[model samples]
Target: MTRHARSERLLLCDELDRLGPDRPTLCEGWQTRDLAAHLLVRENRPDLSVGRFVPFLGGHLDREQRRIANGDYAAVVDRVRRGAPAWNPMSNAKVDEITNLIEFFVHHEDVRRAQAGWAPRELAPQLEGKLWSALRRSARLMFRKAPTGIVLIADGRGRYAAKLPDAHGTVVLRAPVGELVLYAYGRKGVARVGFEGDADDIAALQGAELGIS
Candidate 1:
């Protein structure tokens, strides 16, 4: 089977090259160059990648990211396009496919949807199914801190609920699985999802911090 994640990674790298380092992205405070550096660090630097979850290790990761970002922009993009080194787990096809499919897809949208005149890309049903499968394993964690119950409806597919133990009010978000994944990853303002619930609940959920680190 073709590795969709690999294709998305290359495509995103090309986009970074096309847009240049100064272009904005949906990732807070990250321009294209910063995003490229982040991808490189994520795939290559195991130590720094762990810092994504370990708070104390983050300062070093941030400094390294800055150093990478300050290097020649074209070279950075080329490195991202070339992907992780052979010894890195991410360089393994199976590992990259399972781990990076949703990652690259989301980051690709982060770049695409953050710019002017942006629109949703039409995705294949197979790709959508892959994304939904990944979301099933991850959605609850992403929305674990949500203020209210979250009912995610993958339009024409299925639903997944992320609810607090004593949660009362609920918010229903209906959208294609791809868009729902985006919302689950904290892209609320840009994700094309329909909200159904009490206005207060909706507001609170929308305003709350969502997504993994």
Candidate 2:
């Protein structure tokens, strides 16, 4: 089986190199260099990455991220390209795939969509299936805070009830799996997904804070 996580990592690295460090990315306030440093911290520094979920440690994570971002830009990008080191749990192929697939895919789009003249890429069906499978496993938790019912349709893949019906009813989002993933990841402004349902419900879903932090 092909490993899309690895491929996305390399592609993101190439974009980082081509665009140089100062390029903008869809991650608000994060440039290419910062994004690269983020990937490195996520893969290599489990101790600090906890700050991503534990709010109190955020300052430490932020300081380390800035330190890495301020260093050699080329070196930072190269480290991301090289992926997690032997000591990092993400170094295992299966673990990396299970964890980094969506992480890299979202971040890759984060970098691409923030640029000028960028377009969504056509993804392989296998990769789309993998993403859909992953979505199926996590949609509820990801959409738990949605103020309205949520449904995601991945064209040929299938439909998923991302959130249970709420008083506002359900809103459906239609897109290719990759785009749906982007939308679910809270790249709402950049994600090329179409919405349908009662206008109010759709609006509520749109305004709702989404994605895991």
Candidate 3:
């Protein structure tokens, strides 16, 4: 697990290095270096005092996200927020670790796909569990939109299987574990995955409303 985290950080660092200082990235309006700076800030800023980190009241993170999603990522954020020496900073939020893990994992792909147009990076084997847990949960969240369930079959080398929580049938997706994992998160296109169940549901997951395309 530790190694996976370290490897993940290294991969992101490599992508950032490759992007250099003046290239536009997949993330809108933010340059590649700008994304790197944002990541560095997120990882390093975990040590701030409560007052500095969490705001008491306002529009909330959702509102903040809306503002930033269509606004300037660089203008509002400081690129290099220094953090205490703890390797990586963490949050006290209930789901902080899991949420950040997914954020980093998906965005790592986002950064790579957006800028270099490269294949997904190789992830640690342990990531299979975290990925399964995450995708399973996210599947439930996305289930309401579909009449059936989707079964995601990874390389099966990892602990994950072509799991379908509750549905009429199963849909199978197989590839290199890393690529399959990304595909399950709806990070990769539906065509990249081999489907084995309801075509409509599969198409829904791959639909424009879901935003994987």
Candidate 4:
């Protein structure tokens, strides 16, 4: 049902290889090499993965990630292409599909959209549906601090209330499902979604910090 996860992972690895280690990505300060190393740590070092969500261990994670990124860039990409190692729970096909589908797709776009002249890819209907479902599951957390009410609207894909209305009211973000996913992931600088609502509320939403770390 979620085979797109594997395809997206492979595609991201290909782009990492093609673009080389120094290319920029939409991930704040992370270059391609840094992103690849983060992926490796995410899948292979469960101990370090906690650092991503735990403020105290952030330094340790950063140090370890830098250690990995400083190595042979080609070797890093090759390891990512091989997928999670057998010892990692992510190596289980079902677990990988459930967890990595959104992770890989968003990171793929992180690399793609950072490049000049890049445009959104037309995702298959099945992939779109899966992304929409994933968004539904995580929308509230992603939009938790949004200044206004939040609704995501994708034509022919239905709408979801990511956050209920605040005093300023709701803002509707209209775009393809994939774009919505990107926006929810803090790729606001590159996501092509449009907004509908009170001008002030929309503006407030635009300025608000959105997405998970």
Candidate 5:
């Protein structure tokens, strides 16, 4: 898991370098520089990472992010490439494996799938299995605000339920686990996932707010 996470991080950094700082990414209103800074802050700045969940500190967090992002673009990417600093929890191998595997993979896809002419890369079967495991555990939280219950059907791998509270109905989304991860992360338009169920339920799930930042 650590190996996968580290590889994804390095690849993301390479993409940022290739695309340059001003290039647009899938993250709303954020350019490559902003995304790079976000990755850095996520791993290194515990103080601001808390603001991701606590609304009151968001302003301060945004301010600090902008300040960090103002550094040389290459330098910022280099920092991300170098991995989390020694004092950071993510610097611990086990913690990084548990936490950042999905984080980096999703963010990596955010940059890749956002660009024109982009295509999904083939992933190793083991990596896909790992992603599926993570999705099963996180599906509920990621889709907590979903308007309908979601049953994620990974082609040839079986199914897992996303138990959203107050769900009006259920929708089944079928795709490879890799694609399902993208859809679960709210990338419905680009994830290549297919839907089945009552039209209303499908529509509700498709349009609902899904995934965490």
Candidate 6:
């Protein structure tokens, strides 16, 4: 579970190369190649903060959408690889590297899920826990002043959601952890996930909290 900075980069490149242009990704309007390009850009640019990253991300997203439209992911890959730079967003190489890991991990699975492919066998368990907390803790200000009884669960990582508000029994969801990460980002909903109970409600709750809906 001890994730290092360099390993995350290797994972990104490996996954992207492995995915290639023949696959589809979970990021809605993106093909495997397009998604790879988008991620390449993000990983390289970790110098920007969340706010700055948004604008930069928007441009890549626009390009990505076009790549998918043309169904020519190969071109997109070429464009990015030609003269692209790595602009770490977090301002902390070590910190941003972990963040980068989260990004690559989630997006990689996003693409795989869209194509019904399998997850990478080498995914790090250490990251699995942090990602869940990052998502739940992210909603701290947006949700209640403090966490109620909500027991936000993502397996080994007992992340935020300390405020359950009287909900009994953990709202268990048996989904690919990667999909769960995207869900946290408001990139998808329950329909796109494997679930147990009240899928609609979970989606609604997640959407409302994350502002996806």
Quick one: best TM-score, which candidate?
2
Evaluate residue 149 in candidate 1 and report its C-alpha lDDT on the 0 to 100 scale: 87
Query: Scored by Cα lDDT, where does model 5 land?
Result: 0.86
Question: Is candidate 1 or 5 superior in lDDT?
Answer: 1
Best by lDDT: 4
**Model 5, span 171-204: residue lDDT tens:** 8889989899888888777899888888888877
Write one digit per residue (lDDT tens) for candidate 2, span 126-211.
89989999988888888888888888899899898888887689899999999889888899998889998999888888888889
Question: What TM-score does candidate 2 reach?
Answer: 0.96
Candidate 6's residue-wise lDDT over 69-95, tens digit each? 356555555443332344434445556
Model 1, 10-83: lDDT tens digits are 88988888899999999999999899999888877888888888899989999999999989999888888887
Q: Is candidate 1 or candidate 4 better by TM-score?
A: 4
How well is each residue in 81-168 modelled by candidate 4, as lDDT tens digits? 8899999888888888889999999999999999999989998999998889889999999999898999899867999988888868
lDDT of each: 0.88, 0.90, 0.50, 0.91, 0.86, 0.49
Candidate number that wins on lDDT, 3 or 6: 3
Candidate numbers, best TM-score first, in rank order: 2, 4, 5, 1, 3, 6
Model 4 earns a TM-score of 0.96
Task: Give the runs in model 1 whose Cα sits over 4 Å from its true position.
Answer: 164-167
In angstroms, how far off is 23's CA in candidate 2? 0.7
Q: Over 4 Å off in model 2, which ranges?
A: none
Question: Against the hidden reference, what TM-scores do the models get?
Answer: 0.93, 0.96, 0.57, 0.96, 0.94, 0.57
Q: TM-score for candidate 6, please give it.
A: 0.57
Stretches of model 6 off by over 4 angstroms after superposition? 1-8, 43-92, 117-124, 139-150, 162-180, 187-203, 206-213
Q: Backbone clashes in each candidate structure, one number apiece? A: 0, 0, 0, 0, 0, 21
